[model samples]
Target: MENTKSRKQPSTVFAVVSFIAIVAVLIIMINLGVNTTLSVFAGVIMAVIVTALLGIPWKETEKNIISVAADCMPTFLIVIMVGMLVGIWMASGTVPSLMYYGMQIISPKILVPLAFVLCGLTSEFTGTSFGSVATMGLAMVGIASTTSIPIPLVVGAIVSGAWLGDKMSPLSDTTNLASGVSKVGLYDHIHSMMYTTLPAGIVALILFTIAGLHYGGNMDTAQQQLIMNTLADNFHISLILILPCILVILISVFRLPSLLGMGLAVVISTIFGLVFQGVGFVQLMDYAFNGFSIKTGVAIVDPMLNRGGVLSMSELLVTFMIASVMGAIITTSGILDVLAKNVLLKFIKNKSILVLVTLIYCYIVNFLTAGGQTVAIIVTEQTFETTYKDMNISRRVLSRTLEDAGTLSAPIVPWGVATIYVMGVLGCSNAYIPYAWFIFIVPIFSMVCAITGIGMWDADEKPLRTKKA
Candidate 1:
């Protein structure tokens, strides 16, 4: 901790100025079509310059950077594995089966609501919104195109379902990061989130139900026939193909490690790919690293299937590294805390305001940092843990807030990795943002709960902060 001793804390004014400048630069560059990776690099350069001007030694900054990166390494691995899971599952026809069967079952009358719920379940099982969107979401979009329902509405249902699943899933990297960073157990974190998630999910479903009823109609039978035929021609759609999904659910039900479960699913899918899909072992390996390619003559379906592989996640990984470096540099300079103490915490004395501030902080991090949920969680937890302790708030509450904002907000921010990936996969525009019902509801519900102390630990409970309590 000698490095900690060597750093000089900048005044609140300097800290605020530095933050605004960095955020402004990032936003301008991103909007100008500069790559998000480059924007993060620019932010890091600014952060380092601030540290140097503050007289903090570069070695101390290096140590902080390494420490934060080390903390994030597990999340990186999980995300990479999630990429592989998508690749293997898609190649194995597990995902294809799900899409085919899902399309076959849902009638136009209940399409929107069921699509939302189905995508949610798929994402919850897969633990990645990107994966859910690339597969199930793509299928929904393709199916919706043949109907009179608005594409934005369909995209909205898909995003709403996918993000909600990502928020609650035990296998989700964001969920794990939030809980781990906040020193809460994984199951405990998910359980706590249900208070807000369940209510918001129900509300979202109701809205979707109303939308489906209004927009529901008979889609072109010829178009639906062609899509189903393409899926059948390409994949060996069968009940057995659903096992991988079942395996993931069982793993989560039994409280197993997500890495293990996702890895197992990948292995099983790989074997299935070889045995059923006739994908060779060498090809399977290629698909795991480089992703699966679909050559179906159908235009709408090909893009949806053209996803997965470790390489596909390269952009996200680079974004993660760059943002982590920026966060580390700012943290090392001690500006993050100074700004937090003087600017954020100055007026946040009570639980209600504190909760709102935490939510806002997480959202700001997502927007400014390009929506790295793990980065947001780590930063928010580091910034707010002490405040929560002093306020007698439970860490579970902190965990829930981190997700309610950080995880949920990512898919709404146009430049966020999750949003970009989902949009790219679904081939939809930002028109869906206004329709992403669940994403908007959870945070508002969280703020309401915080103000009323609903679902929060009692202030007088001695063991309120304990994991087992």
Candidate 2:
């Protein structure tokens, strides 16, 4: 499908009303306690109706929706594969081994910063904040509970670390989606994010270190030992168990195709599960489809280990489809174009204001859309691409900004899907918001980068463009 330029642009009134109507429906439906899937579907209906009212043909609108959805097919595949990878890694003892070793080495003095770093590493490796939170993040919570450390502080650290992976990981769907929609290379997008991510990470580490030192806990080493023992007793504990993870890292470093790398890694992990865990082929297949389950006779460890599967990704797949439909209709109907040209563009004439406004727009969409990063990134990119081109800025900056704001903002919104899912998994309260230092710091750091033109490129410079989404 071509760009929306060929489509008839609605008048400013029609465009503004259409955009507001969709947003209003989303806000109302979400506030009314409807499920996110339902809320987004309602938004889609509202967008379709608005476009019809604006005199766009239904068939044309449908074509646009289908085109956009097709573009998201790769994302859909990646998410499903991610669910599979998570399940296999768990069944193969890869994740459990990491958790066991991580718990053993994390001293009370470094527990807080270690929590951030460990969760970040897991998330970066897995490429899903929810996965990292559900697995290693839960472990952090368990560790904190056994110590005198504050659960909220640990939860904050986990959230911060999880988002680091979510933003920078090549396996991350949000990272890929942001880079994809912005028409930038995946590694390029990840590389650009380091400008803000690095400094924010350093600052967050300092804060976590200070907080840990001041309010440090008297850790119960016995509980930690128990966790390690239980893991060892239940699964084959070996450094070689993490070969799949190393495989993924190597693939990322080599700059190979992400889906291919992850797909092969999942197969290798499944094989490891069969060989080391001594499960039969049938059981491995079951685990791949329905997720791994661990009883371990230990209530706390069971939840941490028993997660992942192709089925686990179904909700996200549906949610992605719904959000994409709404976005597609908005773009196809030319409402995005109208609003951009008449409304947003009027104020974001300068590059500095453009970056700030884009960041703000990403946040608004993220929260209001209930924390679907794909919708925020794609819609933000689609709405602002022309403006960025007009201002002669690089699309890599746009991709980075999306990661900084859109990808990072999801977990901080108390009611957003990412926050709710992570909190539920880690058993942490929204009070951890103040402590999620990395995600919060990144956007501010990015804004400062924009103001200083630190990582951004001018029109006259080499433009970082890729094949259009």
Candidate 3:
């Protein structure tokens, strides 16, 4: 873990070949329809070969790997904590109450835009699109299914809202990751993203509103009302069920570590489960491990509420481990160093070109990697960190652009994990791609800002004008 930097940099040929090999393994395995964790594991294997080819000893490389992967222990802990929080929230009827009350006031007239807003708020507080999808998104999709509104369009709005909030939320893994990798302040990274994200959010809201008006709420609501009634009868629906959510917002406002915040919040939610839901400590522990399960007699609500638990994130945890190993190998072998300095840097000409190239790389990686934002952000930020510094560009710009391209690209790509997850949860297809307003809008805003030099800050975070020429 100490100064293992004494290893020689891999030659250009070795570096390029190694990089391409790992990328090929990822793209091929992913496209071949293999499990995502397996695909990433293959990439890790390819990484091991790359290190061996470069004559880096396994001992030194292993140490380097552990050193790098250890940095993510906190992130991993946060993920587990989020899982526990989700499970406890469900058991405590917190999520159920939100869905219940949400369905209470939802005017079908504005359901489209309201779905977007509700998903956004849910994702904002929960810090995971998966969490929002499991709770609010499922509820919205259930209501939409009971209506004449297009399911694909509603799913699109839901995806937009989920990712929009995720990109901005401080507790989001991807958001924190982009900032961490680029060495930007978390708040500063979120602030810098406003340039692209703000416009995109507004445009998405307006588009959804127009669609809502066009749809016009012409639906039979007896079933929707029945579902709401079912929720009311089963779960304890009260204003106090929302304390867990309030705790999350307070944690964010206080700018505490997500792992610590989520840990404390999970405890509070566990108490709520015991006090409000009449769950025993052992039963709560079971829920913590295997997720909450309840038979509400409503087909939709049961599945939606059945989603959280530490074990539920097994695939995601494995993917993180694989990503960490692959990333560590790339760093330890020094190939990334050679490629960035000798190859990538040679092509970077100016601010606009740099931003464009970065964005393209991110999107391509995102699509090829099946929409894992962590890998995309890591590779792009590491590849360009020196280039940005050399060009006097702020790292915050890197963080912002990473989200605009990488995070946003996830839900839009048909083969992406995020897109597939959304489709599965919403019981829809790739048809939602055309309607993910916010995800698509940010890229346009990003490109325009790059060309116009708007929001392009210098290394000092000072406003600067870039010559488009």
Candidate 4:
């Protein structure tokens, strides 16, 4: 009893210490105006210190550290590959062609909402937010600049749409990861998500439409046409560029592994680059490593288009490392267990409180770790598995909660991977966007569904009941 009590005490101490440290770092980060990467690194270091001081075995802690690193490797590799693919696609005129056509169809009044809709379509088809952002999203930035619309608003629309598609699309890696982690069927998961996702999307569209109607008339047609023409002249725009996008969509619709599908798309793009764009073997290699650049003699255009490379992976990697380590510490030291038992579960009684508390906890975890949506889902799954099971809630309920809070809220947090990347690409400050309707609305919508018991099913509540043993 003495030894067991001693162990419990250290665990309790560690939980308290880590929680305090995390709060302190959040306050300091806010005061200092530090970016998410720095804040996450500080939190991780503090967590490690707390864990050590509380007597977590060094070997056990080290194992978790290594596991975090290994789990993150696929993301790092995907980031690098995506960067290279973007570079090549840009150089080959694939993205430019799509943009040229997109610009022709867009009117100033519909630009903002259209940006959302278009990005949503592309991300759905491609099953990649990063790929959509690199290609057509970059074009939208140019279009937004020409139209005098706020960049952050445009970025918000883009992110909102991109993530919407990511959540719904069968091909998205995160979508697969979420379902896989929850042990839910892919179709069932996608279907279940729609209850929350569709409403959020509709709300987002309405908001973007209203904003567009107010700001669309101020767009400069001459400048927009000029940008389109410049893109057209720089790269060979044609019907063929659409093929790679189609291939991506088809593969995704079939629900193949995302890596394999994306790899196939890359191969198709490379072939097109060689045959139609006259890209040489040497240039192809360079584009994959260093990214593609267009010397358009236009200063803004050059920088806007000349991005994406293997080197771009470093910053994201650093942020992930810090966030993952912090998460590892939090889990290993039993901080989450303590919080779940003493605070969250204690206060959560019925479905309303359950949903709200889960949402709050998921968001807090996402904010503290600065990790992506996948990490958020992983944490929530582990943290709430028992609670959810005990409450007789279907795993889909937890999955829905994860997406509503974790996936949608990621882009709003300044330090989160989605927010940071969008800001970097669009050159928009996080605070400039007054309203992110989708991010704000999805959680509310999800909770309402939960409270009403519209989408939830108790484990034993199924119609085709199993016989008792």
Cα lDDT computed for each candidate against the true fold: 0.80, 0.76, 0.77, 0.73
Per residue, candidate 2 scores C-alpha lDDT tens digits across 1-469 of 3434444558899777766777777778767878767877887788777776666767887897788678778766867776788778878888877777667666777778988998899778767676567556765675565567888898999999989977888878788888888888898888889989999999999999998877665766777677788889999998899788778767755666668878888889888988999988788778878988878887767776776787766666777777767766766676655665677778975667888888888876675455657778888888888788877788888899988888898888644556655654454556898899988888887877777777777555452233111
| Model 4 ranges off by over 4 Å | 1-17, 30-36, 180-183, 424-435, 462-469
The TM-score of candidate 2 is 0.78
RMSD of each: 4.4, 5.8, 4.5, 4.1
| TM-score of every model versus the real structure | 0.84, 0.78, 0.79, 0.88
Q: Per-residue lDDT for 307 in model 4? A: 67
Clashing pairs in 4: none
lDDT of 1 at 145: 66
Q: Specify the poorest-scoring 10-residue window by lDDT in model 3.
A: 1-10
The list of candidate 2 runs beyond 4 A from truth reads 1-21, 28-33, 118-159, 162-195, 211-218, 349-351, 364-403, 406-436, 450-458, 461-469
Checking candidate 3 for backbone clashes, the offending pairs are: none
In Å, residue 200's CA in model 2 sits off its true spot by: 2.6
User: What ordering of candidates by TM-score runs from best to worst?
Assistant: 4, 1, 3, 2
Expressed as tens digits, the lDDT of each residue in 1-469 for candidate 1 is 7656766679999988988988888879878989867877888899888998888988778998899889868767877887787778788988778767766877887889988998899778877676567556766776676678998999999999999998888878789888898888899889889989999999999999999988877678787777778889998888799898778767766767767877888889899998889999999888888988989999967765777788877877887788778877876777667777788888886777888889988877776556767767888899999889888788889999999998898888765666656654555666788999998999888876776667677434334323212
Overall local distance difference test of candidate 1: 0.80
Model 4, span 1-469: residue lDDT tens = 4433334334445565668778688658856988667887888788777766666676777798788779877766666666666777777777777667766777777888988888899888877787676656777876777776777778878888887887787778778877888888888888888888888899899999999888777867777777777877777899788777667667767777656766887788888888878889688768777777668876656765676665555576677677777777766777766766677778877766877888887787776666457667887778887887887777877777877787777777766666666665555667633556677878887876776676666765452123211
Query: Over 4 Å off in model 1, which ranges?
Result: 1-7, 122-142, 148-152, 169-195, 214-218, 385-399, 420-432, 462-469
Which candidate's lDDT is highest? 1
